[model samples]
Target: MTPTSIRPFPRWDDARAATLDEPGLLLYRSNLLGSDLRITNYGGGNTSAKIRQTDPLSGETVEVLWVKGSGGDVGSMKLDGFSTLYMDKLRDLKKLYRGLAHEDEMVGYLPHCTFNLNSRAASIDTPLHSSLPYAHVDHMHPDAVIAIAAMAHSEAITRQVFEGTVGWLPWLRPGYELGQRLAEYDAAHPGLRGIVLAGHGLFSWGDTAKSCYENTVDLIERAQGWLAQQREAKKVAVFGGPAVQALPEPERDATLARLLPVLRGLSNEGAPKLLHLNTSAEVMEFVNSADLAPLAALGTSCPDHFLRTKIRPLIVPEAVYTLAGAELRAALGGLLAAYRADYAAYYERCKRANSPALRDPNPVVILLPRIGMVTIAKDKATARIAGEFYVNAINVMREANAVDRYVGLPEQEAFDIEYWLLEEAKLQRMPKPKPLVGKVALITGGAGGIGQAIARRFLSEGACVVLADIDAEALQGVEAELAKAHGKDHVRGAVCNVTDEASVIAAFDRAALEFGGVDILVSNAGIASAAPIDETSLALWNKNQSILATGYFLVGREAFKVMKAQGSGGSIVMIASKNGMVASAQASAYCAAKAAEIQLSRSFALEGAPLGIRSNVVNPDAVIRGSKIWTGQWSAERAAANKVDEGDLEAFYRERSMLKRSVFPEDIAEATYFFAAEHLSAKSTGNILNVDAGNLAAFTR
Candidate 1:
């Protein structure tokens, strides 16, 4: 088999390319590299071009590598695809890497002195790209060459195959070690065109872009020929008889359905496409062979790939796929039970005497009954990549074992790389701050002071807020105020009674329809009762509990259901009064209702945390002006009956707090914003924050 010819970019003249800015040139060059070299099919690699520009005042030239930007596919990168960095600043990272344990903070803390601040993340391996002395560097997993790397005598064979064209590496996990080793090898063997990593992929470089691209093609073509020859010469036996059995269409789909989620879970992404599978008798026979067990512990081709291709495959015997869903379920039950037990044994073996246990025991890849290998990636791209890599590794491991014992990275080293600082850095970059941004929030009783305040806060912080209230006029009035303060689109108004379940649910449904979904929930609606226990009527007791307690329950239940269904974590802020914590005279129903809301919030918090949702109770003290309880919207006679006067209310509320000041909704709003921000709250779950202007005295007033 002949390899694809490496194409030269006759059209891309560097003088013309350099006419663009550093970023523009970088994107163009990266795209050109991907296009010229067949290695990076479907955006499989990253490229960087380092340039030194003189500082006018100092008369000193500084080196900066314009790396590919995140989220920009190398295949279609543009001028914006690149981010410039001070090479001197980045090269300094080598020193920090040796002494510092947390590399991200050390690296991330370096501000963009020359580029836009809002630029997407620096390429994950910017240091490697920067550390290299080469003007042009390209990293890719060329499929043909990767196939060769999997061979047992791949290093010696590739040496004979490439004949001084590329350097060889024993596959260590990528990142720090790969970069360090490459640098060291390059120092020993200067001017090497590319590197051939065992059980992994290839890397190529040159003084010029064209040279690097051509060298890469040359190396891959040689490796490809070698692989084709080996495949042709090798005779593989099928364990089963000559005939292959195929699964029926319905059964196949049903089997796929069960496997898809497990695959997706392994891939750490949404469902990925199942490309063509090899289900021949020979393939099935190879899968069921005893050779698989020993190599199963070796993880994915790459650690990051695990989020795509999980560790190990589900090995199935030949007869399994012919069954119905129930039969498949039973088969899966038995298979998974054994798999988990094996995983536990593996986990225990892997664990040092005392360490945290593994979270997921299921294999990322699944070997189906008479179905070839299926990779679970978050998406099709990842799944295919994972599948290809796994298939390549298996082939290589076979060849290596045939020659001698095939050794892989130590389990501890694999674990370290899997949980490496670099991997953690990727996770930390976007920890889902402001997850509720651009989502709708509906707060009932939003016309009154506390409700109005909460509504306004949500609006100010980017949520499209609907302030629902029983009073039509008050709702319209508050809506107008919010519209005047926040833009018209930020606030919506609906007149609904908390006591009416139909009206409340209808309001929420309307908000969901208008705003796509409810991401943040602020359940702040409540009624107050002020009467001694002896004088408190059944009507009064029922009314307070109905709105303050039961209403919150109903709204909360709906919100939880909606959020959990959405699958993206949601946040619920239940505004329980400090009254729930401390007793006050003549307010039995209100106090009891508030206490119940607090407990409900706690339960929701515990349940939701696992699902990435959060429920927090905000104990707001003295957000009293226009409060339904204080404003007598329910009953003015009740306010007078409670002996709460209007004029001195602010002072009276302030006197109760340790700060001697009333807590405002704005303060609560800031706290809300913090929780919603992407970078704050490292592990804030089932937590209650008090927003009462230093009010520890819940009973003093």
Candidate 2:
């Protein structure tokens, strides 16, 4: 494919570029290059510009190398995300370098070279950028380029593809030594546009930011074009053709729904992990291919890929797919045990004296033939990004295998990079995990005000939520709003009528597919009705019971099913009403239904205790503001019953409470969050907390 066909055209706007200083131009160039995954995966590359700036301490002009800071993604970074180091200081560090063994000490000297006292830590790639003899430099992991770089004869392929315009360097882990080697090569061979780092990525440089960006894109496109040509000429099947055809869409989804929870449960021996499933055509092709096992065993070629996806994915054997129910689960448990044991052996084989204690041994990526790929991590974003990295790896493997034998980084070399002291320090520096991190919640009536509030609250604490609502329009709007605030990966929406058993089950399945499984169930879907017994029709009575009582039962039953399968225990928080414990006038049906919800909670608590599942209730009364139930006839009916105008209902409820406070959705959300949080309520199940602003009559006695 040509650049126009396979790669994105340069998005540089001259007008935009003209309005920025050198540092701004560098940022603009980095964003442009990082925006396209075809150019590089998220946080997989680094960019830099050597700019002249006033030295803050000396009040004199000096050249500073501004490079993407540690753990920052160039695609979504700001000016502050770049670390500024004095060029002279960086160059002077060459005197202290004591070869590869002491290369790590070089990182300690970096802060001493800070140009502007910038707090953003410089990445290991700083040397790679600072050593290059160019005003601007970009190092990227484009699949098309990595394909050529990961080949057995990568140097020969690089020479053939670029016709000597681009140079090639053999596999050397990124650090001071590699940077020195790069400088040596560039000095030895002047005028070369770029160098493909074998079994890694590509590095390109130019006199200006625009030139550097174009050079990088152009080189990647050229490699893409060559690979496309080679693939067309070969006319061979990918991964030696599909070993097994993919199941139909419905069957595939069912298979994933069945497998994900079990995998998630098995993988959560340490910190619980969220799961992300990828059923894209590319993923399907690779997983179903005959070469899947052998190629996967070779592991990933790029360090960025392996860091996120782990060295290699666990390939589920064909026999496991033939079993069903308990037999299938037992089979999977055995496989996971073996995988963990193997990972332990790998650590034993490669660990050094000072290496960080063995990390999580469970596989991050799992490939199942006919079912696509599932990635597990501490959060939805990490899991999804891990899957994306694996996809990039798959692309590299596919293209390389089509032309020449693909080569993964040697195990010892991969181990050194994985267990590097600097990398371990970075991990140790990460912020503490949130309270609800790795927990998945399925919320019923999630489009409503209280539900949305609960969703937001849960999200803020780092839980993935699946919102289920019968109102499709409201559901979509709430989903978009929450996803915008807390990332698309952390929230999903399913239109579910809670009263319908199938809808309830589908909602749980959706949770399993979107995340791993349900760790918390918030049974908040409800309605309210007001009428004297004689005036209350059977239909009206049944409607209240159906939504309030049956809905809670259905959703709770499904949550219990998933939780039992996981064997990890879970929390169930029912949003009952104060009326459940207190009789109310002219609202017998509503009151009775709510009372049923309270009773069901106790029963669930009793039944779930042995399984490590806890059931609790949050009883919220007169929650008028931002409530969907109040927007209907229920508000006017209650106003009439209280002898107050519709607008005065809130004030009436407030004054009626002993605390003179009207409850809001957020208040109810707080109560629900308390019940759902294991750290707070793990030992307090079979209890009810009322959020009624001091309603004595409704108090649980």
Candidate 3:
């Protein structure tokens, strides 16, 4: 190894360590370990330490294990994120451990034995940590470590590295039994520095936090070094050759435009959610090669991936890439059907004693040969996580390819971990999410006040959003801001002229490609042009009708086509104006065009019903004076027509209504939210929600 080999391992700098007491040090170490994305991902790993604390009731000093609490990311963990457990009692769990069936009950019992008996929720691996005799213990699922531990010769590799100083535990479903086995293995090897859990992860320990952390870094570094040697030894006769076959046209992004919605329709899992299309050069090379295709059929890199990516990935054949239209759809459908049938057969063959509920059979990662990788999940975050696992699995497999044969855990073992109740309990403990958690929403005029408010509201309700507008600069600003808050996958902005047929189609296509498909469509793009009948020009009438009325038809028709293709019911919330239902003087062009827009929405609702689509309207009158739609000339025109100051438009509407409350954009946004919610309006399509501050004339039965 040279002096400049990029280190491959984290080096210690004691001066930078936090000046903290034992408890604070535990938190400090957690933050340090978790901060490195290579050491630990978002919430994949955990850490713990042993400290002495007074047992208040008994008035005796007792050893306590401070383990990371469940549901908290290690990088951001605090003192509260660690559960204070009595070490002796936690170790007793290993004595009571019988088999995998009691693992959930055993984990449940850990919280009751805590120092306060009301401490933070304990990490599921508390017993595993408690069983070891070390003062500090650290566990993480580092990418490089997993590559070595997930191999067929994991035991041999461990024996070779530490020469019996480190122990190897075979694939055991993580719970009480695994914890018990760890203790037994540690006891047998008295000089153990750490242990690698095969097909799971790694654990390191020492008398001090620094030592334990360094031990982990050093151990992983050595494992990485071993793999690197194997890599250097690998030789290829030929890596490049003549074109294998004609490459797919228009590139992977264009192919995804055709495939994502169809692939999303194939799933019976959650709603149409996010798709992570990885078209990186590394990924593209693997998918195109005949050699790497068979490697994907094997099980996951580690059992942990089973929770997200499932046991195996589905590789859509190369032929479908060249096909198009009905023929392509049919071919893809046949491929999905075959994959499902095979999964059913696998489930039947490996199902446990008592019939266990099968997991969602839909493959999370779908490799489109010569195109790239497509990962799907219930939400944007999970899709990214699942994608990470698949990518890591592929990397590990590639490494195993260079070192030795890549071996996956057995099918029954996969089922054991897949159906583990303790694992499911962690998911159950998470709080219930907002109503539209898995749905996708597209909002028109999204950079405008009413449109931005509607987009933000839907995002808050857990709907992944796509913001559309004609103003490219404003659209980019809103997209960057929202993406920062909700993640880049959750919110996006597209420049769209709603009146144009091709642009409208492209916007929906972007939604289908960005997210898997569109679940909710908010047609909110329109303008307010105020003029007397004699003053209104033919051009004015044409422009107002084109956007206010025709825009809805164009965007609505595209959403319908996409929704119909998805084979799932969807919702469309049209932002019509109160002027549509109630006439206003000097606003002839605006009122006439809005009236046509509202009726168009009703017509869409009536026709949409048979297709399981819901079309609803929210008729909003004058918004707050400074709202986006009324910012410039539009605000001045409305103020002049109403004979009131621009700032008084809000007050004017408030005083005109029965409720006497200002009809801000938020009020209209609230109405749009209500109409989009399936629980609130599932049985009531063709509905018009009046948001004009309780104006009776605008209210519809």
Q: What C-alpha lDDT values do all the predictions have?
A: 0.62, 0.92, 0.78
lDDT of 1 by residue, 1-701 (tens): 35344332325566766577655655665676566433554445788888777755467887767776654568777666677777776666666565323544545544543433436567556656766678888777665665556555678866777777678988765554457778888788876777877756777777766565556666666665665555446543322223344566555544553443222222222221222244444345446555555465554443333434455567765555545344644665677678778867766666644344464565556665435666532223344555555554554455444333445545565555545555555656754533334455777678877777666666655566778788899889889988888766557787777777777766765554333345567787776767778888888888878987888888877777656544556677788877788766677877888888888888888998887778877777767655566656424444354457656667766875688877776676666655544346536756677777775555423
lDDT for residue 390 in candidate 1, whole number 0-100? 58
Q: Which candidate is the best by TM-score?
A: 2
Point out the higher-scoring one by lDDT: 1 or 2. Answer: 2
Q: Please, what are the lDDT tens digits per residue for candidate 3 over residues 245-278?
A: 4345457656777777777776746545567777
Stretches off by above 4 angstroms in model 3 are 1-16, 94-105, 161-165, 236-250, 270-272, 323-325, 428-430, 483-489, 696-701
Name the 10 consecutive residues with the lowest summed lDDT in model 1. 265-274
Instruction: Give candidate 3's error at residue 215 in angstroms.
Output: 1.9
Residue pair clashes in candidate 3? none
Tens-place lDDT digits, model 2, residues 1-701:
37356646566799999999999999999999888887888988999999988888889999999999999998899999999999999999999999998999999999999876799999999999999989999999999899999999999999999989989899998999999999999999998999989999999998998889888988888898999889889997899998998888888777777778887888996688999899898999999999998999999989999999889889997677667678878988998899889888988999899988988989999998988899999999999999999999999999999999899999988988999999999999999999999999999999999999999999999999999999999999999999999999889999999989988888998999889899999999989999998999999999999999999999999999899888799999999999999988999999999999999999999999999999999999999889999989999999888889999999999999999998999999999999899888889889999999998888788
TM-score of each: 0.51, 0.98, 0.92
Clashes of 3: 0
Worst 10 residues of 2 by lDDT: 1-10
